[model samples]
Target chain A: MDTEQQVMDHFEATCRSHGLKLTHQRLEIYRALLQSAEHPSAESLHKQLETRLPTLSLDTVYRTLATFEQLGLVKRVETMSSQARFEAKIEQHHHFFCDQCRQLIDFTWHSFDSMGLPEALMGVGTIRGKNVVVHGVCNDCLEKKKKPE
Target chain B: MDTEQQVMDHFEATCRSHGLKLTHQRLEIYRALLQSAEHPSAESLHKQLETRLPTLSLDTVYRTLATFEQLGLVKRVETMSSQARFEAKIEQHHHFFCDQCRQLIDFTWHSFDSMGLPEALMGVGTIRGKNVVVHGVCNDCLEKKKKPE
Candidate 1:
């Protein structure tokens, strides 16, 4: 099986192992995450999922998203905005945030041999690895600035 | 004048220039932020400032902090944590997050220009400069790991 299929199979088995009921809402949230190219906020996800899960409550969306975050199935995208967004990619990588357009783009560049975190901190919290986020303007934003005054 | 006094004077003057009412709550909040070595959350600031401003409502604390953030007197520290934290040091520098202690330690190795963050990010929502936050285990965590017989 391909990597995507392999991941899905694992997720299915893992959910079963964890005794989490795979409700329609949970499945829809998972599908919405998988389908989105843009890292989507709960509000965005709710809008997308509304077509299928018409009766879905906003609270349910938040709860489902929170559950996926806890399960390590999705990663939260950081923005200066109050609303939270998330991504489905689970691999070790970095992010490029476009300050102008408010876009979060994926960037893959690994520079560290290990986490290089200070040795003094551990057990206080579980930090699995580095989630390096680099902020800058994307190519589109760069082009927009070249327009005449 | 000392560096701290200079910063306070500058901040107070800036507040005046903007016609922002520098109430006791604002000053108390500013003092609390200036005193904190750890990038502290709104709740943390509220707790600290309350000791001085007993009549200060949580709403006032939040509003004062929001104002401080908007006035460029403080910068928001991004984290995966739910609550937002503010950095008192507005100068360009990176942070060393102690995952164990949940503290943000500032590391000023080089100027923002020296970091070489792409110029495209400039002027986009105030890309003051680049900061390389190295997330890792601190020295204390490493010592504890080796202690067990």
Candidate 2:
């Protein structure tokens, strides 16, 4: 859903199906997650919403995100960082993280996605999902490193 | 590095090389991380070490782990879970995480490792490392699911 209205509609429907209340805070949180490309953490989300939502507490953001995660409304972006990052986009994709700038970029791997699970993990479990995180320096950071002061 | 003494020797050498003090708490924390296979978070580590070191606080565990991570002595295991997990094993390997049981198992992907980075990721950045996380229900959890109470 590209538009805020579309996202709101989806959010309302999802909440209804899951029997969740369509609170203003929940809508705002969901909208923020949908708009953000940074894969923000709960703390970051709270900070982002604080100006608009002067009364919103960090605890509320944490609880709402946890509830959304439990219902699969949002997916957590796994990273080497201590704080957990999150995304509203739950599509099948991979991530490229720039260690220098600490940017989390999403990229799809059609070949890997089509190949299915690796032979190594065959008998280990009932497979659900797979994610690949590539760590490196992004082009912008690399270029910045190449330039002398 | 299998034995505790071997790990201690390596830890001492690493600490000396990195110009870090060989404090008793740091040594114990490193040893505990080396011994654990759970990819325990700082809170969990603090809980595990508290009885042994009554004065040890969760903040200490967090700070020590961040220091170790900075020094490349310990690596963080990325996961969908909110809490960040850590491991002392720095070798190149991937992980298999059981969503139901929350168990993190290590496995090597020689084929994927040998193949190198995918062409899709080419020209995007200066590649450093890659990790694959497969999420699923472990055999034990699957077996449990099969049996009715």
Candidate 3:
């Protein structure tokens, strides 16, 4: 089976075991999230799905995504923007965000997992996950600055 | 001179150098940010300043924050909530975010700076700053879970 099919099957089994109904709309939303590697907000996901599923409401999309989040099916990414964006937990990775344009780019590094976590933090509580965000100006914005026109 | 005073002076000098007006309202907004270790949103800041700056409007607070951010006088922290929050660049540090209640707590660790960044990200663009977030259930929430109401 291909990666997408495998992902779908995993979501299906997880949902079934948790007694979550994999309705058509829920599945479509999950598919959209899996396909959106850029990490999409609820409104953006709604816009992308509107053409394909004309009758889909933004609220339903939000509710479904919220459910998925509750079940650990997705991870919400941090952005300077007011909108909360989300990404699928396909694997462990870190994000590079452009402070100028608020663009979030993700990439993985094996070294991060092996880094010694501070004992100070460990004593505070149980850590579920860790994320690092490298912030700077993206190439597009840097180029735009170089050329006024 | 104390650190806060030095920070305020730096902000004033930066504003002057950039030809940005440091009006009374702007200064108050900056003051609020400097005092807020919790990193408050514009509305929260406005509410906090209501007594001393009774005439200040929410829109004006928002506008001032936008100007301060544009001037590099402040940094916006990413929270799970849709309300965008701002923090004064008092110093470099990381955050501990409560996954249960969405509380963001700041703490610093020097080891993160020594970790080598992945070259794949270096190829993407220029990186100026980095922040790490440790996600977990806070002590309060953990206790609540242990005793169950």
Best-matching candidate per lDDT:
2
Q: What lDDT score goes with residue B36 in model 3?
A: 76
Q: A44-92, model 3: which lDDT tens digit per residue?
A: 9999999889999999988988899888888777777778888776578
Interface RMS deviation of candidate 1: 5.7
True contacts kept of each: 0.14, 0.83, 0.79
Tens-place lDDT per residue, model 2, B17-67, is 999998888988998999898899999899999888999988989999999
Between prediction 1 and prediction 3, which has the larger DockQ?
A: 3
- Cα deviation in Å at residue A54, candidate 3? 1.8
DockQ of all predictions against the true structure, Cα-based: 0.24, 0.62, 0.70
List of clashing residue pairs for candidate 3: none
Give TM-score values for chain A, per-prediction: 0.83, 0.92, 0.90
> Model 1: runs farther than 4 Å from truth?
A1-3, A17-23, A112-127, A136-149, B98-102, B108-128, B133-149
Per-candidate TM vs. native? 0.75, 0.80, 0.88
- What is candidate 3's local distance difference test score? 0.84
What does the TM-score come to for chain B in model 1?
A: 0.82
Question: How many clashing residue pairs appear in each of the predictions shown?
Answer: 11, 0, 0
